[model samples]
Target chain A: AQSVTQLDSHVSVSEGTPVLLRCNYSSSYSPSLFWYVQHPNKGLQLLLKYTSAATLVKGINGFEAEFKKSETSFHLTKPSAHMSDAAEYFCVVRTNTLTSGTYKYIFGTGTRLKVLA
Target chain B: EPEVTQTPSHQVTQMGQEVILRCVPISNHLYFYWYRQILGQKVEFLVSFYNNEISEKSEIFDDQFSVERPDGSNFTLKIRSTKLEDSAMYFCASSGGRGRPDNEQFFGPGTRLTVL
Candidate 1:
């Protein structure tokens, strides 16, 4: 079975400060990792994805995440936080069932980010 | 930019009633999916549709749930009997090209289903 765990339920940071949201995963094989953000009453937007091509993946809104296989972690980071960056973040792991040949996405509990002005 | 669209932003229904959630995937996308999130819970995948059939489904997607592509642009999820536990935010998503690991999935705003 595959699963993802988000270390923090909530994180608060001051504007212009660096932000970090930790995520770890457990999978039997190599997996694809992704970071998604959701604003209040908005859809989940893709921030970045790791497909084994690059250890460090850059995404929209100046967000990026590094996939560290040794640590079993794919943590999201932003150099500076903006007021609009406040939202719920989710870590997702994609895996496939051998028999079905179908993809399954496992999501983490999520981390709510608060940007203080 | 093209994106997925779901109908009925919110739906409230009595227990045991039937509810249909509709989605219009991106015109050029070939793979469509349905996901749900209970209040304060992680988002869970329900099912995936491609080539006019269900390519995959999670354990949560039981016999009570069914999906259909009645038209070229519309994908629908029907719950045979709604339960109180079924209340959640349902999201529709789609991806272009084959349903591969690298294809990015774009999500819709989501439909809030409330079963009273």
Candidate 2:
């Protein structure tokens, strides 16, 4: 089984300040983790993914996440928050098994980011 | 870049009425999926289709729910009889290639279904 837990339900940050949104996961096998952002009335956009290649993954809009194996965490961070960064973010876990021949994504409840100017 | 497109951006139907949501995934993609997000809830996976057949489905995808490719370009999801609880935002997504670990799924804007 695979599951993701976004530690924070809501996060508030001032524009120009650093941002941090924590996520943890539980998977029986090697996991493919992803961070996705959804703007209001928009589709889910992939920010970045960790597929065992790099521990520190950089994504669009100056966002990045570090995959920590020992802690089972993949937390998203940005050097500075922008007003446009306000949106709902989801932490997702994809099962890496090959026998399924299908991709199954397990998503977290989500964290709503509020950027203040 | 190409992206998934969904039709009937918003649909309002009475309870027990049938609803069909349409989607046009990326032209070259092979794996297609359906997911739903109820108001203030986590996004839940419904089903996945490939080769004109269902490859996997979640428990939430009950007998009342069905999916069909119908034609070469469009994928459709049908709810035989919707309940008030069925009102939610339904999103269609597609991923290309051999379903590799790096194959990221592209999503549609989603269709808001309001069951009255």
Candidate 3:
């Protein structure tokens, strides 16, 4: 079974400081990993994805994540935390069905980031 | 920028009542999906639609749940009977991105369903 774990339930950082949200995944095969951000009362927005391509993936709003196969991790990070960056972040892995050859998304519990001034 | 959109920001219904949620995916996208998140829970996949039919569905998408494209633009999910446990925030998403459908899925704002 493929699953994702977001290690931190909540993380706080001062504005202009570095932001780090940790995530780990378990899969039998090479898996596709993604990070999504959800603002309060808003939809989930795609931040970035890794599909056996570049290990260091860059996403919108200066967000980026590095896929580490050895660590089984795809942690999200930003050089500077912005007040508007405060939101819930989810780590997701694609789950493939061998019988149907189709797939569904398996999401993590999510990490809530709070940026303070 | 093209994006997915869903209607009925919120719906309140009694148990056993039927409800329909609507979404309009980005124009030209070929794949559609439905997911729901109960308050304080991880988002769970319900079903995926492609080529005018269901390509994949989770265990939660039982016989009571159904999806349809209806026309060229709208994709809808209908729950035959509602349960208190069914109360959740339902989101609609679309992909088929530029190449890999699994690459990225643009999600709609979501409809908050309340079952009484």
Candidate 4:
């Protein structure tokens, strides 16, 4: 079974300060992990993905996440938080791919980040 | 940067009425999926479609839910009878890789369905 757990339901950070959103996962095998962001009135956008190749993944908008296997964590981080960075973030894990070229993608409950001025 | 698109950003319907949510996946993507998020809840997977047929579906996807790729560019999800519980934000996504590890699915802006 594969599951995603976002540690914080809501996180508030001061403007220009560092941001950290924690996520953990349980999977039977090495899985593909991703971080996605959904701004108000917008679609879900991929922030970063961790494949087998790299453990530290960089995403758009200066966001990044490092996959730590021993800790079972893929925490999202940004050096400086901007006002526009406020959004709902989701941590996702992809299970084994089926023969039909698809796999089950499990999503976390999400963390709503609030950038405080 | 090709992206997925969905129609009717918001929809309102009476209970028991049928509603069709439309999506146009990326032209090159081979798989399509539907997911929904109730207000303040996590997004749940509804179904995944490939080769014009459903490859996988979650328990929430009962008989009332059906997915179709009527044409090369369009995929649609039809709810036979809308229920008040069906009110949520529905998103469509597509991926281009063939069962590869890095094939990330691109999502649409989503359709907010308000079933009354």
For residues B21-49, write the lDDT of model 2, one tens digit per residue: 99999998888999999999999999988
Report the C-alpha lDDT of model 2 over A22-108, residue by residue, as the tens digit: 999999887899999999999899999998898999999999999998999999999999999999999999876555578878899
- Predictions in order: chain A TM-score: 0.97, 0.97, 0.97, 0.96
> How displaced is residue A35 in candidate 2, in Å?
0.4
Recovered native contacts in candidate 1, as a fraction?
Answer: 0.67
Residue A71, candidate 3: alpha-carbon lDDT: 98
Classified by CAPRI criteria, candidate 3 counts as: medium
- What's the DockQ of model 4? 0.65
Residue clash pairs of candidate 4: none
For model 3, residues B52-78, the per-residue Cα lDDT tens digits are 889889899999999999988999999
Off by over 4 Å in 1: B99-102
Off by over 4 Å in 2: B98-102
Q: lDDT per residue, candidate 1, A2-113, as tens digits?
A: 8999999999999999999999999888888999999999889999999889899999999999999999999999999999999999999987564544566789999999
Worst 10 residues of 3 chain A by lDDT: A95-104
Ranked candidates, highest DockQ first: 2, 3, 1, 4
Cα RMSDs of all predictions?
Answer: 1.4, 1.1, 1.6, 1.3
Clashes of 2: 0
lDDT of 4 by residue, B76-100 (tens): 9999999999999999999866545
| Ranked candidates (lDDT, high to low) | 2, 3, 4, 1
